[model samples]
Target: MTGIAGVLAWIEEHLGIDAAKGGLADAVLRHVKERCAELRVSPQSFLALVERDTTEQEGLVRVVSVGHTWFMRDREQLELVVGRFAGRGPGAPVRIWVAGCATGEEAYSIVLLADARGIPVRVLATDLNERSLSFGARARYGAWTVRGLTAPEREKLATPSGLFEIPERLKSLVTFQRHNLVDPPPRGATGFDAIVCRNVLLYFTKPRALDALRRMRSVLAPGGAIVTAASDVLADGTPSSDSELPRALAKSPTAPPTPVVADLTPPAPWGAEPAPPTKAADAAPVSDAAPREAPAEDGHGAVERARSALDRGDVDEARDLLKAALERDPLSIEGYVLHGIACDASGNTYAAMASFRSALVLDPSLWIAELYLGLGHDRLGAKGDARRCLARGLELHAKAPGLASLSSATQAMLAEGRAHLVEAAAAKLASL
Candidate 1:
């Protein structure tokens, strides 16, 4: 491996951050050298680019934090924002925050999405590093960063020269600031309706991630959601709950799953054999029972009944039957997946996520379950979880058609779901 790859590996191992191959590390090194020349960075300072901050100048930690953010990054999330806030009679000014907004893709993407719904928005876009923040304030992007938007979305939201010329109308909606996640958000910054911080948190240890999540929670307004890269989650380590809380986890774009052998779940009856590891006495209990659902008479029969109802356009009936099946056999992966799909069709998004979770517990390799999980999270406006589920599902499913065995009606719905997710992910990246 070259020096850059070595650095990439170090970053991944230490920070769990994805560093691009090729000369990206070289580019980051060069940028850091040029930017830190005044401070006379030593080898230690160069390496400190990836370290956690302890001093007041922590925001200056350098390393080109180019996220894979494109325009309109999560189209579905944007759609929800537009339709719910803008499509409805607009009243209160929508307050949004885009944290770790490297080069402004996420911030700009929100602008594009909000514009589509005709909802006026105010965004506070911030980053720890000044270099990335500078680019965000400029809002100029090249082709790679502009990939997600439809021609019209691009034209309407972007300047002719590809710079986002902040419109006076929208200017009141957005403010650029610098804030570090390691520390409290600057005193003046508090309370937001939604937060978009995509593809930037693979950079810290678990403790650091947890700290960032707590701080995010502190700033979020009631009913507000937080967004992250597809694979990232709230470092808060809190098990998700159904009770409405001040903060909730959002689904990010779906990324690939980790290697099968590396998965935390036990291996399936037929997949790869895993090496046994010694467990501590206090290790968390592994529930072999598939996330405990209600009992079913016959798993296969339940699937068929749900499928028939779905085919006949009885969406509500299908949902109800699927739920019944899950109640009958909580460990039934098929039942859980079908239930999730049905719930989505019936618009009970959170329940759909629970169903998907049950299914994932029963069968971690069920790519279809992951896809459903993504859709459910997206519907709940949990973009971060949605992105992770989708990305991991894509990794597991690869070229597999998740709805291949379903009837045309069901297939159509599945296809629509997939398309929406893909477009949403594309859009989320565009603003990066």
Candidate 2:
């Protein structure tokens, strides 16, 4: 890890932000370079200073992270919470926790809606970014943040001082705190009626995310549930009321799952694990067996064991298992994909690309392989390959519904859209 890669890793560590997602890698590199020029220091020196200085780390993270949220961002979810409260007799004020409450819009929005229905509420809003917490604490915002509300609604809720300021009544109902979801919950952070953690967990690594979800679950009152973005697919056990949320968590390309002793869920994404290899060519017996009671690599369960290794953060094991799996099932496209993900995880760029290339050799039009190859190429500064692969990926998944049809591993890697990845590729194209 050095240069751009090292800095991106640092950002992911300190800020708990996925620097690789949604063109964030390019953004971080550009920001660091510009900051280096402004500060009159080399990139290496700047990173060193940031490593030791808490203030610098916070400042750098503030500039690089994205929290593009607004009031009533998901109105349906809010309504669901408010309606639940209205049904209950007066006992305790509805205690709502707005985890990752960016800029406080969502927090304040909760209060305003509850008030409309004459339900009392108290809200605790938290985020990892200090800058965002500071902004939320101000209780003021630009008009663009309130675009969801009509003019009459906006006027009723905010004071116009060239900026939309929430009235003190609403502001007093909410408290803003700086918090990293990866860490344990703030002391005594418990007994919440609702937890609105939307569009936030998608960036977290699997282990860190599960930890956060566990903490959030501890704070929930009886019958209280978490409302998350549709895209977030949490691991099994922790429950949420959001019907749109996926039942099982999938792998994020960069962050594999933490080790679990017993994982009963099918090891494939959204219950769509690849079928047993059909061709006689694919029936080649597994040459090398993995540790423990796991079956040989050629078996269907080989993918399952590899997925298990990923859960344990043992990419080396995963890579080996995938290798034997692919060897046994030469025509298995998903085998090649899993192999590529494991190779990428182990930082073997050449082997990773080969795995993806092998998939392409099998089927030139495979969107999963082409898309990841482009993302991996962009990260390693292969601009030409990134541009070509991403263009094809974006064209293949142009339809909204098709995105969901991809395997779990592919979906997890694609935290955002092909367009987002393509824009980063385009940036590299311009640089070239």
Candidate 3:
């Protein structure tokens, strides 16, 4: 039998939990089988030794139990927490807990953020596995864990080995311990300002999940909030309410709000006179035309400016100008679209999606807007939307040569996007 089947059988026997009942262990085990090979566990061979229940079995299980987390795991949630608690002044050495802190990425990130803000935070980082704790205590990290850090943050926080060097001055501010959330947390581990268990509790049964949450709540200060992965934090069983301190914070709504009516309309084309204003109800909606600024002097002219900056590889400058143009006039659909382009160039896919979505909301009939939105969605791993948008853009382009002709650079992007969606869809289907 495959190691996954063996694991399922072994878990059912020892934990007295049935995989047939659809427990967290079942999901975790499946993910473990898929990813185990990367982590160096031979899933196929591991299955053969299930009856042994030896040290290797425990080792295999621990590897499966530990989770993968990174700095800024949920980027928006990190921003919110930093804004809420760490932004506060040196107040009684603000306490925080990171449960199931495997490999210490999230815990270390919390430390870095708190220190950067000069908050007096005492962090208690814990995990159930001794080996995982040892790895964390060593403070060495891989490149992937440090991917999100800004250069300054990296310089100030992490050692050359990629671990945050716990400076003596801040040594008292953080502690690491090995504790299982399945048991009561160690004495004094509770009653903190915030508890971050993002992506961890999704591995437990509902009863286990509730118990762990209650433990998190028992020690949480009246207003303290628990942050979990967006996948696990649901409205049906959420811990936060409208007015109380949250036991858990649900994912913030990410969809754009309904578009508000505006007085503005797109500028008339180059040499034509201004079109007479039609009544609001009778006016034909504007296409994706943008607000025009008198072209900046001493630079490549308007049409070439964004392209020139992109060509010269001055990405930050391009992004800044695009952002400024958008802010100066929110009606600038071109500005919004280009800002999304700049964000994608700079490797901020999430921010790019937000920008693209904003552009489409301003002018839904815009094929370029739809095209770029599809590209952004594809890059962010949304294949279905990407395919639909690309097909839609092609349809519009067929109707009008002006609509169809993409810049060579954008054409290359479209090609790459198409390739990625096809590959992703195929892999997903094969897995099923």
Candidate 4:
């Protein structure tokens, strides 16, 4: 094998990471070069050391694996965990394992949520990287990690450092450990009440991923649930069997069931909308109103449902429902707008922009779409686009009727949008 190929093979065999399947081969090579430079060793020598030394192999895996995660990364799944155990009496401890916990944002988020809701729970957070576990133990994070938190939530749990430091109480609820999913369950990891393994399986080949899934399933307590990425669904578009968190574990060891996989894929924006049907040559064209009215009703219903899902912090469900709404009526302005909101909440800025742009295409009068589109652009660091869109939205809002005339939700959205716009402008000026 070529040198790079041989190294990649080693990574897969030892780390259970299929570099090519993970689309991270290039990144792994880059990390290898950086590591070699840091150690003052030749590439060949470094590779030899990694082969011979277990510690070096572990360090290499840590460097190659991306740990880009944040607090409340998937709010809906967190809510599910809370809802399940919050009301239970203290007879049995609510056990949760955050597999691939990556620096502890997800694990700590769970602990914080449980405390806020008065749930008595214990969290075991494990990852393959020892350095990441050490960082999690520190419980300090940059502001970007806590962006989704409300002011009250931030004040209650964090104190300001160069980066925010999580309160000791929250940190005390979780135990971080070094563990690998490709291996057997670590001691004391069995019978968890809930297991959260989001966004981790995509790193392996299908066979390896299945093996990891089976291992994860084996450790669950009877009726315990495992939550994963929504994209991990079955071919039929229904949530895979793994998503049934409340289902009782089967008696047979060989009958390993699937875990709940939450979908995080952004809904397709307006550009992918199907074209309208052509009119018959012999018949006069139908009035635009009749065709428009029917779809509008369907779209409105769907958007309303999406809004309800969002209210409950079920972002995946909201996005899925919005996708159906848009499919039913491509020109549904409200559907596109609501979909944009869901995408923004889920950290999908580009998709959010596309959804907002689609809404504007359907109705240029939608000031809300412009406002959200601007916020999305700002998050993506498109300063010029952000400024123009925000300016236009604000101008439109000023010309509209009194704020008392709008719905409470719309009022809230407008206020939040304005705040983001001002923040973006201030940031731009600070850089000058």
Candidate 5:
């Protein structure tokens, strides 16, 4: 009874997968058609199959995934971990989980690094895509995957066929498995010394990602850590829209001092994400205290400078500064809204709308972002989207108490930089 739009909504809600910007939306359509042909069913009937079978619905995760990976693509974290474990010399082989291991390059890279450091490690590599896992399990990689190895390192892994065949010794250290990270870690997969989920959480919605991180923390041995690509994190080492929102999410007694440690960059990390959770008021309010870097020189500083440039009517300067600031801190909600405004002032309505959407993706409660986004949509002649955004913004802004009663977990999310959202939303709606 549902079409493609409804199907996508289902996937986004259930699995927190946003196929829109990743070019996977079209792949969904293609996958549906292919499955229908394979099953000799109509599109409607295929939708029925997707609903009845969990496996059918889960297939979309694979559909959206690409397995283009080379060894040591992002190796700093791997090297760091090897050095740490090598020095500690845990009596037994250290256990590591490589989530979203595309075609085994990262997992194999970890093994080689640890081998070179004279430490033993057991890597449990996983991916939703079975094809990639199977390829990894084979322990044979093309020259590209081996290009990063030093001549001495390359000499150790000799193959008559010229492909880099992992030696049985190194191959023995890794185990490949099919897994869905959104679910709990597989059985026999507890108490890891470290978990390396590189650049993978960027594919997850914020809350969904946090949920996975919490799960990862549960299985980590005391003093163990979770490693992620540097670009994959937010201001405080998590991919939260509001810099302060995940403070509660980051807390745990048995976990390592820092649950998350980032590495490489996350790929174009803003478009769509989960909506805000039901607001809670029973918990005590948490004081704002995450990593507040250089009040005069960091993201906060850049945003203030951009504001000054805008007041001086220099839209270009403001936009450039805002862009740079956002590049450094994508979780800066103020920077995003201001960037949208600057874009609009520069007559780049589309970019303005995208910037506003990015803001909403982090914190939908931002009535200001919704109102401005609606305005952008209106300028683009998209009446339906304009009405939806405007109405939501106006409705949220109408709440009498207005974003003040945040729970201990999220009080820090919007506590700062208020006093303007309500005034602006109300003024815009009244004018309209």
Candidate 6:
């Protein structure tokens, strides 16, 4: 028969709850024993039953999972949200998701703050515990849960009926539902303007936490923000590597638009002969099509200038030039690739990833795009994605016999790409 350790592992796998953590073992043990007693079976048998019966597993999860939270638990985070939304026009649509919203206090707090500031927003509050969600939907809170609020805020938010009850006006702004953070997000939950999942990742193992954070990121709109507890940081205030929140937000969904490369001259037809020079520059006749040709030539020239600037370590100038190049020829694969390189040099890995991905979209066979993309994901602590991209790049690199014929610069890039992949693998192994 299996022992307590076996049962704990089962709980961790099924619920994504690290039962071995402080006090969690006691809580999970108590629930296991309770189930054993009710089922008239031994602990092992109860575990077997839990595995076989989906309802029993869920019941165990509900009993052991924490739902102990109050409104405005992190005032700083709330203030950040308010500050961001304060000046937005009234007609602007704001959507937020409060993941792991235990008993709904956090969800309601967001709505109240937004309403007080005259920001209209819709909040989707989700928890794994149905009982907690039901209580949240009722919008009723005991005195203890309402302790942090100012008297005026409390008075404005709730009507006291034995326990304080949230008014319909505030409650209507939030919708509560049951959700599992480790699983795929529900349909219609994507494209949120913001997602608040503070103080929740601590419950799971690092891998599971990383998975959950990625799921949250998948649903967030481009440039959307995520808030997490300051305690998730290290002594230096940098987020802990084990904590996925910082890594996930590093590549924010709402990245800036792809920069267009500046125009320098009109586009010329391929292999067209240059016009003969005149004694006076103005003596040349102005064709009706000169305006159109000017932009394309200018774009090509800007791309060349950007590459030169990049070679000179002038990332800012390179970026400016590439912006104009892309603006002139949005489909220019070389422009996007060079822009990605500039972004990487500037330490903007997120923007670099976006730029590289855009290049790949334009030309999937671009040799170095996957390499840089993998490196970007590696920096973000998305090891799985990083490994996948690197592997694909390496595979393509292996099949290309023309590497020997490429320019010295291209050959150097291939060497650098391989080094990055090797370093990433080493880092992953060291962590393990």
Model 2, residue 206: distance off in Å is 1.9
Cα deviation of 182, candidate 5, in Å: 1.6
**Model 4 CA lDDT for position 287:** 7
Backbone Cα, N, C clashes tallied per candidate: 49, 1, 1, 8, 7, 25
lDDT of each: 0.51, 0.60, 0.52, 0.61, 0.61, 0.60
Lowest lDDT sum, 10 consecutive residues, model 1, at 280-289
The candidate maximizing TM-score is 4
Q: Could you tell me every candidate's TM-score relative to the true structure? A: 0.44, 0.54, 0.47, 0.56, 0.53, 0.53
lDDT of 5 at 200: 59
Q: Per-residue lDDT for 336-420 in model 3, tens only?
A: 6666766554444444567777877876665666665665555334678877776666555447524233345545534433433
| Residues 1-432, model 2: lDDT tens digits | 465666777766655556554335655676678778888988888788778877666555544433344567656556665776787788778887777775688889889899889998988787666556777888866554575566677788555344567888888888776666656555556767677776565555456566666666666666666766543543342322223332232123244332211112211111211122121110000011122243453545676677677655466577777777766778777667778766654334445677889888877666666767876665444678887886776566554324443367655544543334444334433434
**lDDT tens digits, residue span 1-432, model 1:** 443344455554533333342223444455446545746755455445535443212222333243224556556555544444554465665777777665566677777668656677777777655555665676655443454577666566565544434455654455666565656654545556666655445434456555656666676665555655333432343322112222112222342221100011211111221122111000000001112242455756766777787665445567766767766667666667667765554334445667778877866776777766764454334678777877877667666646543445556645644554444433433332
> Candidate 4, residues 40-113: lDDT per residue as tens digits?
98777777887888767765665444344577875655776677776688675577878777778889888888
Better of 2 and 5 by lDDT: 5
Give per-model CA RMSD. Answer: 18.1, 16.4, 21.1, 15.9, 19.2, 26.8
Please identify model 2 stretches exceeding 4 Å from their true place.
158-162, 234-432
- Evaluate model 4: give its TM-score: 0.56
The candidates, ranked best first by TM-score, are 4, 2, 6, 5, 3, 1
Give the Å error, residue 266, model 6.
Answer: 35
Q: Look at candidate 5 and tell me the lDDT of residue 147.
A: 52
Better of 4 and 5 by lDDT: 4
Candidate 5 local lDDT, residue 278: 19
Please give the lDDT score for candidate 6.
0.60
Most accurate candidate by lDDT: 4
User: What is candidate 5's local distance difference test score?
Assistant: 0.61
Off by over 4 Å in 4: 34-45, 160-162, 233-432
The regions of model 3 sitting more than 4 angstroms off are 1-54, 86-91, 158-172, 233-432
Looking at candidate 4, what is the lDDT of residue 330? 90
